[model samples]
Target: MSRYSKGISLLENLLFFWCGLSLILSIGGDNLVIPSWLQVAGRMHPLMLHFPIVLLLLAIALLWMKEESWRGFGKNLLLIGANFTGITVVAGLLLASEDYEGDALAWHKWLGVVSLGFSVFIYFFLDQVANLFRLAGSGLAVLILLTGHFGANLTHGEDFLFGPLMPKEDKMIALEEAEVFRDLVQPIFESKCIACHKEGKIKGELRMDHLEGLQKGGKSGPFILAGNLDESLLIQRIHLPMENEEHMPPKNKLQLTEEEIEILRLWVMSGASFEQKVMELPQEEPLFQLASNKFTTEKTYSFAAADEDEVKELNNFFRKVKPIFPGSPALEVAYFGASTFDASSLSDLKNIKEQVVKINLNRMPLENVDLSFLSDFQNLEEAQLNFTGLKSGQLEGLSKIQSLKSLAVSGNPFGEEGLENLKKLTQLKRLFIWQSGISESGREELKKALSTVQIDFGFDDKGIIYPLNSPKIDFDKVMFQGTTEVKITHPISSVEIRYTLDGTEPDSINSPVYKEAISLTKTSQIRAKAFAKGWIGSEETKTLLFREGMKPKSYKLTDEPHKSYKAKGATTLFDGVKGKANHTSGEWLGYTDSPLEIEIFLEKDQKPKAVELSLLLHEGAYIFPPETVEIWTGNAGTWSKVTIPPTPQSTKTEEIRYGLLAFDLPQGSFDQVKIKLKPIGKLPSWHQGAGSKGWVFVDEIVLN
Candidate 1:
């Protein structure tokens, strides 16, 4: 024998030994106690697998190529390929001991062993069984292909090889034909929970992919109890706090959205039915509304996009111009900051007149502006000119805009004469003329003039006084650099919004009526209410505003915030973003048991006069005011502690509120500031979790 053949014989013997041992381990893999080190080795199987596939293909080609000269070379290559194949099988067997399970894994593993055995057999019997060697070589190739096919399915999911060529399934089902479980509940499980709890790789031995496995229960208990959310395992796991280890889909995985969880909860409450039709449920039920919204198709518009640079240029603090929905070519324009609006703002939009489908010039101080340009927007479908100081004559100019479908001229002084101009708009479908000095008799006449139009007169008071809804205040950051504008709006037309900036309640007769956005350059409290002729004023809406000072160069946290509420890390406090009452909105940094200690560095020229901590208070949620807050101001290593009064605790349960705690700093010019908040270590006696450690949630820290 040649020297190379002698080496091949030795490797062939080791291959035979490894193949036997790999088969034995794989057969008994179910009970094997795999260690961490072996798991690390098992993960290397993917990286080692390509070598055997490429070498085996080359070996078979060389041996069957009708060239005697290369037969010895092919034999040597076959032994090396067989040895690598044996090692790959061993690695795969070790991997099977982990979370991998299912029919795909089983088939892939056994087919790999068979391929290993076939390669070794072809190598040892090549010369003695020359006639069948060619056929065996072809058979070995088929085994390798089948093993690879199954392995791909195991890793990339079923139909990985030909999923694209298959017909795509439409996810949206009509409300009448949709089954409650198959259409709604099952999809939520497939997207969020099934990956870990499916047939082959069952975690906790629970299978959520189908109804039978879900009912069989897992190691924990029944997945769900019909008509009982309290005892259901699925409900309990999802409701657990995100910090808990047993939370479903895991904290690290894609957490279930609030709406998705609500769907699952509703499904369980409805006896977890598998064949219920969505439309069969009561129309007033929340589940029906959620399903209706899911299946409703959005309106599609056919129009080319506007120039990108022009859209960006037109969008500003006062005016917003963007696509109505993501990827849609149509655009919607809304103007804010009425004090800053001018005739040029409307004229400038002529750049992309064709793409503008909706224009909201609400409350834009447009009394004498030339709205003749509005007729140039040929595709305008909706126009909201509410409370824009529009006169009776301007309605004639709007009538020239032939494409108008929905028009709102509410809160203007125009009477029935102006309302008659809208009769020329043949395409008008809905008209809002509330509080326009047009009485019910005039509205009846206009509705008769345009029989097809739906005229909305808004809130016929009927001699009974109803309280108005509170005005919505729109301003994200409570702290501002130089000045901030706060806009207050009420949905009802012609209702007056009165406000006070000195923290006192606003009487409708005395307080200034809100028209434009309020500009603030100092710390102030704004209290507002809605007022009208026959309606009761709304409950007061209070907002605390602060003047920001000294932007932080950087900051560091002494202890980590809770994993679920870490809002953009150390920069969260100084990022000029504020969180609302909801703590889980990804804006607040929540800390429990530990003090929130932050060291902030400011610009060299900044001399902070005061410090403000924007915090949330919800006794029901176990979030309380800090016991005390300590602040120190200095640069370098010199520090002076500033004494502040203890923060008052909630004496009883109250609604969720966002409050500002301000402290005047000692007179100094300091670039470095350290703020430490000591959380109320334990909840007060009035709280439900009285003996447990409470939490303190902070959204923004202001230095002024």
Candidate 2:
């Protein structure tokens, strides 16, 4: 070959080799990383990509002409097109190696590879295969358009083109119209979780686009467990520390806010129902407030942030100053440790008066003279003076705080006349006057004046008619082998106890009055209620009496009771005495993290009709009713489950009451009766301490 021809052939061979390498790298470049300097060249792929489009189209146009000269020039143009295609594909591969993956990346990758391969084929064989070269050129042109479209999508977002043209909807929704799952919860997943967990992009094999997908769960397990938040992997991952490997969004992506996390936890705790509405939740519930805040558009404040140094100086041991939310300029100043509070504490906050939005002086010893200092805080949105010594006229200067939304002066000496000063605060939404001198008539008049405000005068217990307390049973032993005398007593001297032997409730007019101890002959449910001359009747109290079963001779427990609530011994379970309202009274036995198993050895084999177990359910104390209870009649080796009572629904924190779980026994009796009480493995999601283990308290167990 001639020297000039050899040089041209060598360049062609090198170009073909470069195109092959680019194709290989593009296919497997998802896990690769390039050096920092190469990343700059990688970023230039967008600019370099245009060269192949222009050159390839020009070559195709030249090939389309019928002249011999155009055909000759087209072959040379194809060589140039091949060179630019190699450069574009290689640059795209470099960019792909920088941690990009998804449907857009996949489509762009394979198309660029195909275009490069076809360009190299035409560059070498255009003269030998002219018809095939024309077909490849047309195919290359189509690939170029598709490759560019997907590349644009990867650079910008999927909706970049259509996003601006789409009609924008209001971000906030009315609470009454908002759906709990679809409207409130799903939006959070779309923003923070759907990027990696949507269809075609399941990072952990978890897809969150549809309700069915979330219900089915991922590789690890189900994302949610309805009322159980602790068992839900979705909640566990979100609560993980940011530095932990399992944290959601992987630390590199956007993290869920505290409010968002709380909302998700609450929604999952609330049975994760897709059909429930925001208004369906209790008005006093925290979830209701969170939902209201989310759906209601808040007004923007134009006030500038307080100086950092001034805010720092204002904070002391007695007074604390902080932002209402992270990165927000609005400030909340509260006084603590009443002994350290004085008139001078108010002066420290004067520098940041304009920035302060909330002030709490609860339980402080401020006098009426100190009320003047609050006049400067014109931007205050909430103020609490509960239990303060401020009198009627002292609050006149507070009327200047026009932005106040809530004011609490409960337990103060401020009387009915003091409410007139609050009339000037037109923006006030709530006012509290519990334990103050404000009468019911005065509260009604104030409510009429401030029509929009919710005035709370506390629970009404006034007038000659007082509410009666539930009657108490005076007898210590409720269950006896033979007939026993039962007596009921009332706290007030004027009150009388009405009695009934059947399971029906007692009323004042028909039920017979109890003058002394009443004898019981058999198993009976005795119900009683207190009646007073000028008072509302108390709630009915009932107790079951078993007259035929003897006390157990010996007993054993599978799980030891918690030390704090352990009674004398396992015999405590059979003790005839009932526990008090307080679970911590040492009368009840508490079990945590495990179920309570008690095996009682009866004195002799006697036919027992039923078994009753008394329990306490106090959600605030993290005490929940037993999830399940099983009773067995046979001895250790031949024991059989006689019955399992249905588990009660978990109660909310607002309910603090006591109840009994009764299980019906079989007709036959045995020497031993085994009881198994299983506590909730983890507190329900609605609980504030939701993922922790719960407690079960039992005071007495009776067999009849």
- Return the top candidate by TM-score: 2
Reference-based lDDT, residue 324, model 2:
58
Which sections of candidate 2 miss by over 4 Å? 1-183, 186-193, 196-412, 416-453, 458-496, 501-503, 519-526, 530-578, 586-610, 618-628, 643-658, 662-664, 667-671, 678-696
Steric clash pairs (candidate 2): none
Tens digit of per-residue lDDT, candidate 2, span 1-704: 99967866876887877677786686566556678888888778888888878888898889878898997787677777777788778887887765466688888888888888877777777777776766777887888888887777665546655678999955535445677888778989988987666543566777777778798998899889998988999889998988999899689888898888999999888888888988789978887767765553222346888887687777767877876532347788889997867777687787888888889989998775558778898888899989988786777777777788789888887677776875665678888878888777877777888898887878866555667999987654655657788889887877888989876789999998989998887667788999987788998887766553456777899888876568765777777776766664557888886789998777765566778787777776667888777888885558877856487757587445565667788876577889988887766656654555577888777777
Query: Please, what are the lDDT tens digits per residue for candidate 1 over residues 1-704?
Result: 99866876789689879888887887777777888998888888899999999899899989986788787778788888889999888888898776667888789989998999888888888988788777888999999999998887776557777888999955434445567899889988887887777655677888877788899878888888989999899999999999999999799888999999999999998888888888778878888767765652223455678987788788777888866533346788899988877777677888889999999999989897777788888889899999999987777766777778899989998886776666666578888878989877877778888898888888876778678999988875776678888999999979999999876799989999999998888777788999998888999888877676567888889999876568887787877766766664568888885889999888887777888888888776667888878888877959888888878777887778887788898886777889998888765544544445667899888887
Name the candidate that leads on lDDT: 1
lDDT (CA) for every model shown?
0.81, 0.76
- Candidate 1: lDDT of 76? 80
Give TM per candidate.
0.41, 0.43
